[model samples]
Target: MTDATAGGPREVPPEQLHLLTEFVGRSRWFGGKGRPFQVVGVRRLGRLPACADDGPEVAIDLATVGFEDAQEGSGESGQDYYQLPLAFYTEPQDRLEHAFVGHFEDSDFGVRYVYDALHDRLAMGCWLRSFVDQPEGPLRFHRIPGHELDLDTHSTLFSGEQSNSSVAFGEDSLLKVFRRITPGANPDVSIHEVLTRAGSDHVAALFGWVDTPALRQEGQTEDQVLTLAMLQQFLRTASDGWDLALASIRNLYAEADLHADEVGGDFAGEAARLGEALASVHRTLAEEFPTEDRTADQLAELAEGMRRRLDAAVEVVEGLAPHADRVRGVFDALAGLDGVQVQQVHGDLHLGQTLRTVRGWKIVDFEGEPAKPLAERLLPDSPWRDVAGMLRSFDYAPHVVERSWGDDEGAQQRAYRATEWATRNKRAFLDAYVGRELTPAEQTLLDAYVADKAVYETVYETRNRPTWVGIPLEAVARIGES
Candidate 1:
């Protein structure tokens, strides 16, 4: 490894290497944790020529391994360094292009840079120039008549979203440069392309994508292979799913004293509309893609996974031992339930995955949870999985807010009010979903799915956020009580 601090590159000292390793591990963006990592190799990709007020840009390739020696107390083996990429940009003067504003952060070693190739003029120019020499895929941008393409001057980056970086120019143009490039066409890009082309109003509009024939090779390859970016119509005033749900809950609690029928800001209406939108999205997906029958083996696998998760939860909530039999009964009932319809559904759907604008609720981020493998996330599953996810969101909102307030009585009251609102809206959503009709079997399947989802939540909360475990633990108890 080499240190690029003080605007020059030098072989990273042992102490600095350790510090860099620790720094990467501590980053919220760094995925791996609780594991041993050794920086096996490093290669500097050369510095970018200084342009205007901007300092030189340094690109480096880091090769790392976990437990290469097969030693005990080492982390998982075969972990690839290809998963992690870092870029550093330095400037003699702090003044940067408006495109780079707010994107770069001050670090111990100059300004630690973020890759927003789409919006950063310099990065965008470099990316475009790299692609301009040899166009990849079907789409290609030609220099306009009598206009010379100045790759260095024409690039700019987009704002927001730490997950992915993007760049754009004017209303009709944009490119979302994905940071974590997994193999195969990303579902977010793939699904949105289909929905947008199909004229599905429920999804964001997708223009096109750029990809290379093969994955970019570290150090050796100048051309980045695979889908580098996606172009789409950006939502200007979009409100995310979390904010929308919070607004609805706030209104519902404000009107808790009023009759449920008379309450203003009742989420029932919005919930029903969202349900209808989801149904339409499902219908479109079913039409565009083929559905598969949920075989016994598949159900068994799902049940087994659920069992493992529940067992973990049970370990945490040992205090609920008296109710273990009832909880097991619910699981047994779910395991035995039939009429499982399998289709392409959103693997992870939560309030945070949606957006509300002047128009209506727009579903986004079909990439699913980052932790899961892409193949598993893209697989067809029960539509009720998504339904269950939303229901879980409804349950999560109040509990999260309650914890935010230190579990005060006022907060608890607010939580109760929010729960009531969520329940009422959930019923309304079901009514809209069922369209005034549901076979007894379908209703049973739905209920089972909901229980299964609650069980999943119990495990997730127990592990990731133990303080909030009570919310799902209560849900597990309520399943039997109801």
Candidate 2:
């Protein structure tokens, strides 16, 4: 182990970087999975204020991984940046054995046992206290005007989150730490801050956010610093909408005499409520951001993009070959769309992204699609894209329940009932969103968006869940029908 001083930044020993690369590759949140990556550079972000001086010192770094060898011939692949928050100690942390990266010696700090620091309670206290104290220097903390943060509350790290780490403080507040570095803006924090100030009931209220002025990218503007974490009021009593939908499906399947609408766990009401919540959120986003009409050329370009994706998707997902032309027809009709309103929308809206509280539905995660580039996600798109996503989710809920029953005696009967539940909920949701009978032009637009989403899902399912490929494939068929 190498030696390091306290309260300062230092380079990680170059030889031990391979350990980090291995840890990253094995992680679920790491983007580059199938491809190999090498640590190209490391920039120390800042040290957290740890209470235990005798214990391990905590620090964070942004590590950039390059896929140069694998992508040598291909021009598209580039390096990815990962946020690494680590605790370094002279002795082993038995409690953090699961999160241990490796035993390494830093040049400035010798004989250190390194671990991912999010799991460390003392390391997390630095974040909670920062909101209350509003500390000076490179690490800056800012809060909304009125709310006072509870500095004494202990934080509980949310497990199994993919893109970011979140800590909930016993119904007081929740802190979402952005793991990947994006210099400009993260809509998840920025949008929630706006909604909370507006007194919107459909979202969690924002408390504060933490940023560091010192650790910025080389070419980024001087004013732009990384958005380290966001703090908002915790939805203590909130239940997941996806879980509720599954429960509703199960309730429907259990009843022999009752249809979906007649079942005890009828989800039509919840679906409509969710639609209203989404519509309210869309309105808020439209007011906060600019809303505009796409020119004829832009509409054609949008249609072309969908067609291009379908063309590419058919090559990989052989099941899509039959419906490719029909799906293309839906996209082709979008060329005639005129005066269509486009604005900032929940690009990845789905049942899983919503919560059903005692008051009503609360929509979260305005960050758009997790996989898309930040710039593309920020771009204005049709609100129908959000509608289509939710529609697909409604379809998925019942079918997943049907699958759980297996090829038993009542499988076919359950399949029919699943379709019934999905249809009722989808209709209820769409009616609430549009608030009127859809015109032919609106219907056509909706169809195209749904087709585009299904094509995207096909590609995803083909890669990740091959067995679940039937869901989107079936959607593509019926969606293209007259």
Candidate 3:
């Protein structure tokens, strides 16, 4: 039974509120890092349907975190929502010492020991069973029929993830638990659902997802859907595309005499395959989703948006100041264009977002830019944005390897080889993707999108990795030359 004393969902136990605050502060998925922030509120969403008669109780809580220094008029409130799933036990489990949240006296269960449910296999089993069983509750488990789930498999949480928590159940399925909470359709689940049902081989097939009706806050008219987790086919044998690219770069540098194309580990062929995969996915999206040609006014607005971003980026990235004018000129060229097509795309396409399975290339993560709000991420964008992101990623791969060399001998030679590798792969990818020579308008669009993407990279690197800011700055300098 939930308390409805305050005209809202039940608040987290007052004594346990501090525990959540401390847990969120140290969490890897907490987005408010380096900012003055606090857990302002925590409300119990619901308890999960028990997996067994004697299994630990599972409960989901939503924490409202407020940032003290959020910028006004940034199109965001000074707060964020995070989901915390907890498992309660009668006794503290020594195996889950690292996963402990806190202990409390429960009125129903009494003397409860709480832990992050994601870290507990038994707790995760409840989630898996819910998807398999489809029990009625606040959390709805929607499934796509085909493969039978391995219900007996144990869950192991992946440690390398940053923004979200992923639990792999043996080798069969992966459950991506979204840390940040938002009240709308999640593009990741939605896009994967579409591509999977369409029989697209370029993406991981969506198995099912967990969502619930969002708690309507003050001033809200209607309830919105809040997605919690997504279950999908885990590519157990898949290698990360970024790792593959880095290895290719490493192979190139080892043979000082050989060009990128002549190397045994040349990634040009793979790059072309990836390009074809992207093109196929884009065609499918354009067919399934609403696509439209931007009028002259919309094109002008798009250009203005890019210009504004450049203007703001120059302030944070001092290196961008020199290349700002050239980049601005590239963006300014977009205003004259018309009939630029826009549709749903991989919002943040990069080599890192790809997986090379035995079958071929598989793109993942359709959530777009992590920094942007969900509404902005769902908007239709030109496919050139995706193309430009991959192009920029190709540029980054070799340069990243070169940076590791630091002031070593053959640095100059390595730099030249890096350029050769990036250029060759970029050409191979672009040729395969477009499948023809670009028209003047297409070239204009591609150039602007690439320039815009590079500009974004400059800002991101400046703020996150100051020493590596030179990578994107170099790309920025070549804006007009290409």
Candidate 4:
């Protein structure tokens, strides 16, 4: 029995509601914007210890927000829940002035000033203690066996990413706090655990995770457990694969006479190694998780889903309308296929999601495409989906540098060189990944997946970066021609 009460109690004091709404709108993690809204309710699921009486008290809350007429853009809304980990203090700390949420009146606790706890050292110490001490209750922290967590390590939050807030514990560990949480087994933690325990060198080891089985008054209840956060070993020395690739391309562009392969910073070898690393991850995931063979009928249903998305996308992005029919033809090809193996995969794979370490290439962020439902993300999909994503990323690298050029006379030459670089790396990556050659059927499947990814990118760029929509539109045209 789940207790989902309508108009839940005022978790925060009523007089200070404006401060919260303002803070949430200003935040990058806040999903709702450009729509009339209100924070209807707040469900405080769990709270860490105060750590100090003279300092702030930390609380983990889910704010059930209502977005008026939001379904068109957001897919689902009107009662969405967002995770907000806050610190309530009597006096504001000068160190945390940038992270201040707002000032508030609390009937139970007096006038309270608030800040995002990820930035507060004392508040972060409480978080570290929660995982270190492994507190026992509805809220629990669990770690894998044989790995020791350094309790004395200090906390520093990574301010770069937009999706989740991450705090690094002195280069030893990193804990990712999920902001827009969905209830279920978070694949980010679950997949890392599988690979980590198996001693897979391609992924960072999962240290621990925090979860609570408290309530579902926020919204959906497909699952009872809410994954609060995940802890994993920090890859402090690892360089981002995207950055490394971009640097290689830049090095090529800088040289007057050198071709892509001739450049000292050529990246085809690294790309092939990355491909091998991903293939190994896929093999390990297949061994550890359940896999199934899909029939032609199942492929039809999947194609239908992709079609519906394209149809919906056309309405949002007018540029997609021209290529809609051609895109559908590629998806229709999927309907004629059969006996495709489906297994748990890294739902989203791109150069940005990968790291190049001293040891080898490492894959990170197993959480699939965030827009998809949890059930869909957890489902077994063709490993080609991951391959398609990486392939798309390889295409993106050189174009980014090419776009940076002014009215230089060699724009065309640079574009040609970029194409050469992308093509060579794509070949290296594909050869290493397939370990042989892609059959005609496999190539068709790969093509459809690649086209589908390009379509999604078109919609994304249209909505977020209108100027860049032409990039994907060109890709769509090229894929259609192929």
The Cα error of candidate 3 at residue 61, in Å, is: 1.2
Candidates, ranked, lDDT: 3, 4, 2, 1
Evaluated at residue 78, the lDDT of candidate 3 is 94
lDDT of 3 by residue, 160-224 (tens): 85699999999999999999987788999998999998899899999999987757766988877
lDDT of 4 by residue, 113-174 (tens): 88988888788888887776666555678878777877687889887756888899998889
In model 3, which range of ten residues has the least summed lDDT? Answer: 1-10
Assess candidate 2 and give its TM-score to the true structure. Answer: 0.93
Q: TM-scores across all candidates?
A: 0.74, 0.93, 0.96, 0.92
Best by TM-score: 3
RMSD of each: 7.1, 3.1, 2.0, 3.2
Candidates ranked by TM-score, best first?
3, 2, 4, 1
Global lDDT of model 3: 0.88
Better of 1 and 3 by lDDT: 3
Candidate 3 has what TM-score?
0.96
Model 2 pairs whose backbones collide: 1-105, 1-111, 2-105, 2-109, 2-110, 3-108, 3-109, 3-110, 4-108, 4-109
lDDT of 2: 0.81
CA lDDT scores, all candidates in order: 0.58, 0.81, 0.88, 0.83
Candidate 2, residues 70-188, lDDT tens digits: the string is 55656545777788888887888898898898888765457789888777776777667766766555666788878777767777888764677888876788888777776657778
Number of backbone collisions per candidate: 6, 10, 0, 0
| Cα displacement (Å) at residue 186, model 2 | 0.8
Q: Which prediction has more favorable lDDT, 1 or 2?
A: 2
lDDT of 1 by residue, 36-102 (tens): 6655433332222323345235232333434344555554344443222233465422434322312
